[model samples]
Target: MENMIKKIVDADNEAKAMEESALKEKEELAKKIDEETQKIYDSYMKDALETVKRNDSLEEKKAEKLWEEIQNKQKSAHIKLQSDYEQNCDKWVDAIVSRTLDTNS
Candidate 1:
């Protein structure tokens, strides 16, 4: 009877050890999963940030090009206006003088 009791006690201790080992394995697996999930999230954020920067650069270039075109158009219009004023100044002065003299007469 004593021998049988000793065998039962040994079996119970072996079972407890197995349970502890399984628990430790489960905890390690959970930690590994969390680490892998964090890595994936970090990678995604990095890629997203790079894409936003690239898009912003493209948009800035487009805005600069549009601004340059507008400046060129304004410069052209100013030049044309100056040329027209120079060409018409003498004729306009003569007409105004004639009209004033005729009105007085």
Candidate 2:
């Protein structure tokens, strides 16, 4: 009976030691996983910021080009209006002068 008690106690001690070791290993693994997750989150944020900056730059370029096109169209319209007025001025003057002379006679 004495030897049997000793054997049982020894087994229990060994089992407790193993449980403690497993608990320590679990804590270490959790710590490592937390660190790695933080790294991944930081990397994702950096990449997202860079992408937003690039998109903003592209939008600015597009807006500038659109503004330039609008200015060019306005200049062309102004030139055309001036050309049409000049082309019709002579005809308008001749008709007015002939109508006045016929009315006077």
Candidate 3:
């Protein structure tokens, strides 16, 4: 009967040890999985950020080119208006002078 009791106690100890080892293995696997997941997330985020940067640069270039074209058109229009005003102003002055002289006579 005493030997039987010893065997039972030893069996209980072995079961407890096995449970502890399995818990440790589970914890290690969880840690490894978390690390791997974090790496994947970081990589994806980096890629996304790079894409956004590339898109922004492309948009900026397009905007800059468009703005330059608009400015050039406005400058051409302004020059044309200035030229037209200069050419017509003398005619207007001469007409006014002639009318004044006729009225005075």
Candidate 4:
């Protein structure tokens, strides 16, 4: 009977050891899963930021092109105004010169 009790005690110890080993394995697996999740999250955030940067760069280029177009149009308008002013001044000067010659005569 004593030998039988000793065999049962040995079996109980073996079971307790197995339970402890299984608990340790479970904790390690949980840690590995958490680390993998964090890595995936970091990769996703990096990709999203890259997309945002590309979009912002495209928008900036488009805005710069629009501004350049507006500046060119303003330059064209200024040139036209300058041409008109020069023509009007020439006509006025010619009229004044003719009037002065007529008065002198």
Candidate 5:
């Protein structure tokens, strides 16, 4: 009976050791999973930031090009208006003088 009791005590001790080892392994696995998740998140954020920077640069270039085009169009229109005024100034002055001096209604 004493030998049987010793055997049972040994078995119980071994079972407790196995349980402790399993709990330690579970905790280590959980920690590794958290670390890997953080690394993936960081990588994704870095890639997303790079993409946004590239898109912003492209948009800025497009806006600058559009602004230059508008400036060129405005300059052209101003030049044409000045040319028109120079060509028509003499004719307009003569017509106005004639209209003002005419007394026969």
Candidate 6:
């Protein structure tokens, strides 16, 4: 009967040690999973931010190009108008002189 009691006590201690080991392994696995999840989330956010910055830069470039084109068109129109006015200046002056100082008077 004393040998049987010793066997029972040894079995109980072994079971307790196994339970403690399993619990420790579970906690370690949970910590590793949490760390990996955080890493993946951080990487995804970094990529999203980079994409937004790239798109914003592209839009700014497009706006700048459009503004330059508008300025160029305005400059071309002004130059054409000035050329037309210069070409007609002599005729305009003659007409004004003929109306103001008429020899028919």
Query: Residues 16-74, candidate 5, lDDT per residue (tens digit)?
Result: 99999999999999999999999999999999999999999999999999999999999
Those runs of model 2 whose alpha carbons end farther than 4 Å from true positions after fitting are 86-105
Candidate 4 residue lDDT tens string, 42-95: 999999999999999999999999999999999999999999888798888889
Q: How many collisions per candidate? A: 0, 0, 0, 0, 0, 0
RMSD, candidate 1, Å: 2.9
Clashing pairs in 4: none
Candidate 6, TM-score vs. the true structure? 0.69
Each prediction's Cα lDDT score? 0.98, 0.97, 0.98, 0.98, 0.97, 0.97
Error of 4 at 36 (Å): 0.7
* Stronger candidate by TM-score (5 vs 6): 5
Who wins the TM-score comparison? 5
Residue 70 displacement (Å), model 1: 1.0
Please provide TM-scores, in order, for all candidate models, with all chains considered together. Answer: 0.78, 0.68, 0.79, 0.75, 0.82, 0.69
Root-mean-square deviation per candidate: 2.9, 4.4, 3.2, 5.4, 2.6, 4.6
Give every collision pair in model 3.
none
- Model 3, C-alpha of 14: deviation from truth (Å): 1.6
Model 6 spans with C-alpha error above 4 angstroms: 82-105
**Per-residue CA lDDT of candidate 2, range 35-56, in tens?**
9999999999999999999999
- lDDT (tens digit, per residue) of candidate 3 on 1-105: 999999999999999999999999999999999999999999999999999999999999999999999999999999999999899999989999999999999
